[model samples]
Target: MTEPAQEPPFLQDPYAPYAAMRSACPVQSKPVDSGGRPGCLVIGYAEAREALADARLSKDTAAFFDGRGSRRRLHPAVSRSMLASDPPRHTRLRKLVTRAFTTGAVAELRPFIARVTDELLERWSPGERFDFVAGLAVPLPVIVICELLGVPESDRADVRRWSAALFSAGEPDVVDSASYSMAGYMTDLITDKRLHPGDSLLDRLIAARSGDERLSEDELVSLAVLLLVAGHETTTHFLGNAVLALLQHPDALGRLRENPDEIPAALDELLRFDPPVSTATFRFSTEALTLGGVEIPAGVPVQVALGAANRDPERFPAPDLLDLDRDATSHVAFGHGIHRCVGAPLARAEGEIALRAVLHRFPGIRLAVPPERLEWRRTRLVRGLASLPVLA
Candidate 1:
């Protein structure tokens, strides 16, 4: 993997590289490419979707390194989580948690979501510049997820810290420390839930049934950790990304302000315009295959750029433009296939509520600094602002 210099153009804005890759070739196989992965970078929408659903592309990282003498060790919770495992194992884990994250279950949280948005917005002082990320985006989703998982309010900060470390680029040791700490914490949390069950999703998982089977202790804890991390991280970035997109595109922002009803549809366009996840998690090829005319070999790591695919000209007309009226339901911002995000409903609800409330509360909100001064996160796996400064 190649790490770019601080403040590389690609880090600040990846669309240039994405477009260039799509124009030149749908897929590129070389270590020194924009994505910096050893195998292939799939930039086309169709290629990305196919790669996502292809059984030949494995999610099992452990299996990739089974025969190799790599000294790297992964946390059990991470290795065993559904995101990291392939079918049967992935199927079982997903079955246990899918019900709790279904549309109806998330719909019930709308009132609670509004309450949180109101509480956060009420904190902003009129005419003062504030960091949207710190003041709202970062805290809101974490608070919601913690509440759903029955985590103590006091422990939310630690959860946020660990979650941030897991996704932040640099220092494998930092990722390891965060993973281990979270795993240990989740283990204790699961044990407590087993003894004192509640209405929380974590409590339900502790007792979730699959005919004659139940989740094993490790599975239970790992699933909780997955839900906790995946639940908040993506949503947090998306909120910031969506807001930033609006600030940059005044017409789009004005359209939403005029027709508040457009927030949900507008969100889909915003996500496609600048997705929170730059790429899906690494997928290892189980066997040699051809993708977008490029040949990929078995066991090679592949990076499917979601942000790139969302903007493919073949799939989206005027792909770079943020048009809320455009058909954007097909965007793969949440990924695709059997491993598609289970928390999508909750994310959409949070995005809708948060965006509507933010716009309603501050109709004149604008970037506190010049667009050129903004800094994007350095991680390749996820795309978002380091901080979003705005005046309300």
Candidate 2:
């Protein structure tokens, strides 16, 4: 008997596999979960976008697992957050927190973000070797998100640790432990907020009212955990990916350095080129449906390869090449449809400010190690450098 085909090493370099898969078929059947159960991956730009907005594809993962009689091992806080809900519930949870991340709200934060960026860069000097991922990329978002949520400065470290663990691929136990810890911590924080309210986002969330509706305790805790973890995680990786992309393309980096104002516009291309979220969160078909001419059965998980779709040749001419001038607003780096990332505004502001600050601060910065020596994180869902060693 022929041995089972070896799985593609997606964590190492998913782009090549994504290309091959998309070329074969936009929607190809594959084993998506750790259990090796068969599913499908949508790699075409059009198909992925369609699937994202397709009401037939449900984001309610917990309900899907229940239908199969398989107990979902993830914590309810994670499984029940707005990211994992559908319809009325998702609509409600999202509305409660959307005000905090509006374009105007994020714009108001530009000065504070600039100050934080300057503060983070103050530690590095010219001619010094710096691990950009650890020194700046990681800490900047952590500080910003923690402060926004009123998470005590003392708890930021643990929050980061637990958030990292929650995304640890192939470590279900660790994910469970981390999720539980995060949920517990958020619960305590919410309780504290009740006793002594402040002006932080978390405080506002606790006191938020919509007509006659109010968030339940579980909803509140779940939303808090989701915000605290996701708020920083995507921005952290986006910064690392953005920096790495600029370093690899000296010409693009030069232009950005020459005209710092263009950094904001170039952020979209950078995100499209190497998105922080390689694939969107879990989504499954609620009913049997045909997508990209492929038949998908009901309840089967479908993963939209954001990294792959962003580079689909059909959608983007010379997709592989990094062209900053290209109109890349169509990229799904922050996803598409109703479930699109709520923090896109904040993330864009953070990326723009961080990139401009870094380039201005270290005009002579260069990769300290060869591109081959750089390590990417092993998580399947997140694409980011584990450590970006550079000389300034």
Give the number of the best model, judged by TM-score: 2
Model 1 residue 331 distance off true place after TM-score fit, in angstroms: 0.5
Off by over 4 Å in 1: 1-6, 32-37, 209-213
Q: Give the distance in Å from residue 326's predicted Cα in candidate 2 to where it truly belongs.
A: 0.6
Model 1 accuracy (lDDT, Cα): 0.86
Give the per-residue lDDT of model 1 (tens digit) for 1-62.
Answer: 23223477777778888898789999987562334447788999999999999999999876
lDDT of 2 by residue, 306-363 (tens): 9999999999998989999899999999999999999999999999999889999999
Q: State, as a TM-score between 0 and 1, how close model 1 is to the true structure.
A: 0.95
Residue 390 of candidate 1: its Cα lDDT? 92
Clash number by candidate, in order = 0, 1
Segments of candidate 2 deviating more than 4 angstroms: 1-12, 209-213
